[model samples]
Target chain A: MASHGLTYDGCNFFRQRLLLSTLSGKHVKIKNIRSRDDEPGLRDFEASFIRLLDKVTNGSRIEINQTGTTLFYQPGLLYGGSIEHDCNPQRSVGYYLEALLMLAPFMKTPLKATLRGVTNDPTDPTVDLLKSTSLPLMKKFGIDGEAFELKVVKRGMAPGGGGEVVFTCPVRKTIRPVQLTEPGKIKRIRGVAYSVRVSPQMGNRIVESARSVLNQFLPDIYIYTDHMKGVNSGKSPGFGLTLVAETLNGCFLSAEMSSTPQGQGDPVLPEDLGRNCAKLLLEEVYRGGCVDSSNQSLALLLMTLGQQDVSKVLLGPLSPYTIEFLRHIRDFFQVMFKIEVQKPLEDERKGGDKVLMTCVGVGYSNLSKTIK
Target chain B: HSERESDEEEEQGALKWKEGLQQKAAEAFLRQQAAAPNLRKLVYGSVVEAQESEEEEEELGGLFRVSRPQQSKKVQANTLDCSRFHPDTFHNWDVEEMLDSIRDCFVTGKWEEGHDAA
Candidate 1:
């Protein structure tokens, strides 16, 4: 069987429409083509999209949260997922507001986004069609705008909204000025992999215990034995934060960060932020121990970062402004989570050695500054 | 009013994701109900939120990408808020000893050797 003669036109149509939406100030939201909800109680559904092609999987149960999702398989073992703008507020406010501000002027009326979940997997195509290594999907996301085109900063809206519009969607051209992406660079390092936890199963044996709730999903979910949240603060109402997480198996590992009003947290200088996070995974959620690779199910909470020296790069050379921004993030993470920060080993800048930066911590907890 | 209804729908749309997340989170909590004493999923079950986050300088445009960022940072980024870490109260108590060892390693011009040894 030759090809369907549908590939090019299909991608072109998608690219054109997607680009049009970007110009109009909207974006497509892709889902994991390989994810499935198999927990004893989840609504067992799983359908995703392939970014390079315009296709919909049929019959396979897709885990969709649209209108409190339920399964609806086609005639075969096929699977399919829904497409729409991501409406997560407390989690994705940045993009929504940015859309509102940047595209507000381009629109005489409010803009509506045409969202779709793109799946790039071939072995297990989220949809029935398309090949793996989809460059069209890559091409779509790689088309960059430039400097401000790939950063998250404010311009006071009133006078700077125009500049932001230009930044978010530069020229609407086919080729990207710079890439706009965030890929994890996970590499292994030597360390005794152990599990930690954060929970409050019993009442005053732990009331609002911060220690009990500091749960870490990375490096795997080894619930910490360090129980210390305050009696009435762990699960309060006014907390400004809510921690959500998920592993590659789609097992969401997480916890809330916290601080006693006007107080610093338990300081924990990491042995090495890069190496620490690198050693953060596998299994620990299900058996609450090491993930026996072959014995596990769908993996979630993918954490990728490697051990590297932050000195020669981070503290080395750079334009004052950029370095300042990077340092601010690292320092802030240190104080906020009481963890450690170091330059990332992989994903280093091409021409320079300045790779990515990572923050590492043990366990999870809801440490937001709030009151009930 | 149409836009308002649309907005309401959109909010509802996003809400479903949240609720879905909430539901998954509850299950995740129950599954790993064994989370460490300090870190537990506030919204259990791993939810790979598909959003258009521009954290990568290598990725491309016009769509929402899913990457699990540090949940703490993710929350702050979404809220357009700032996060902080306290050097004064950060972990690691043996600063002087550690620093002395570090200084000694630096002077020997063999920090890696000492690092490997220690």
Candidate 2:
């Protein structure tokens, strides 16, 4: 098989095909299968089998679906019941097995993500503003590990029975069951999560914030999100989808675009013809876009965009309608997020996620303060 | 072709600056984003290569970051800066009040009842 380095262009190529929905654009569904044996080999073998098939096919699609006791199957299915039959290994090794699938030839996984609305942040990553923590790098990455993004349409119980999580992403694959050090037995380690929702109502808060903050901090973010909006078919569920907590630090600038997956309806180019097929396919993520965690520059940009420090740049002084929108936003955050800004990063502070929110306009005050 | 060239220029420019908020943003914004929580902040992606030893991490004073050096300078506010762009929009402040009350309830480090429901 050719060892072409994976890239955003390759991603775009797949995206275009998704838009067309050509006959050859098959989607490989990663349905969680119920298995008793917790053998690492079995896991690797299954993932490898799917990947190998992907290599043979010209360019296949991927659909990531996890199962547990509460898993739902679409009519007559190949895998049934919650695949989380074995509680420990299922959570632990199972995730690992699925992730390694990305390295295989058949594993051309489409990056999946969501966009949370922009909000005020006063503290920015500066030289100062933070202390430190005892979390190991791997564990930190595990709980909030940034890597090849994998998204799925999950069906499960919501936290606090907040309705059904339904289409939530659930957990990132990196976190797993581990044997606790020092005293006693074993338990599963938990990781943090962010949710996102995009809809008419969602535009009110998250997208509204994105309009201002995203434009100021991460302008390119809007470019990418807007460009890809056509390919994504994700539904807007009133509430915003939470972002991966790690990316939250820098996604200061946000935007919404009408994205359509790459290929709406078509076939592989005649010259593009090849004879391989893969089972696991990637799905196009639309309005709710997440940054590819592997791109280091993007993380930096997100932080800059979300930085609480007020840098002036003809941000507004717009028409009455736009100004009213800003007014309502401030009122909402003050009452809702009640975000606090503590020890704002001085202009010179260097390193740290020192930015904080105080639910006050101070987060974006400096220049705007005089505006009103 | 022109677009690719501009991107290269931007990337090169990003690489040259060593320290600044914009630089940090440039770094973090370019990193990978597989999965994360909501409240985390500006952090760039690294290769995820394991360190050689415990002492090595400590040797760097635990200040080693995998992303590129900072590459931005704080833009001094011009007249009608970004903040002034949308000066009047307001939102529901009640949610903030609720969270503040919940935070106050957790005098200790534990969640009490539905304290964390928000």
Scored by CA lDDT, what does every candidate get?
0.22, 0.21
Query: What's the lDDT for residue A352 in model 2?
Result: 17
Q: Which stretches of candidate 1 lie over 4 Å from their true place?
A: A1-67, A70-88, A94-147, A150-167, A171-372, B1-118
- Per-residue lDDT over A18-94 for candidate 1, one digit per residue giving the tens place of the 0 to 100 score: 22222222223222212232332211111111221122212222232453222221111111122233222111222
The clash count for each model shown is 118, 146
Q: Which stretches of candidate 2 lie over 4 Å from their true place?
A: A1-98, A101-199, A223-372, B1-118
> What lDDT is reached at residue A132 by model 1?
10
- Kindly list the per-residue Cα lDDT of model 2 for residues B10-32, writing each as its tens digit: 89867666547787886677663
What is the per-residue lDDT of model 1 for residues B42-108, given as tens digits with 9 covering 90 to 100? Answer: 2221334223233341273236544444332322221211111111222231233322221211112
How much is A74 displaced in model 2, in angstroms? 33
Reference-based TM-score of each model: 0.18, 0.18
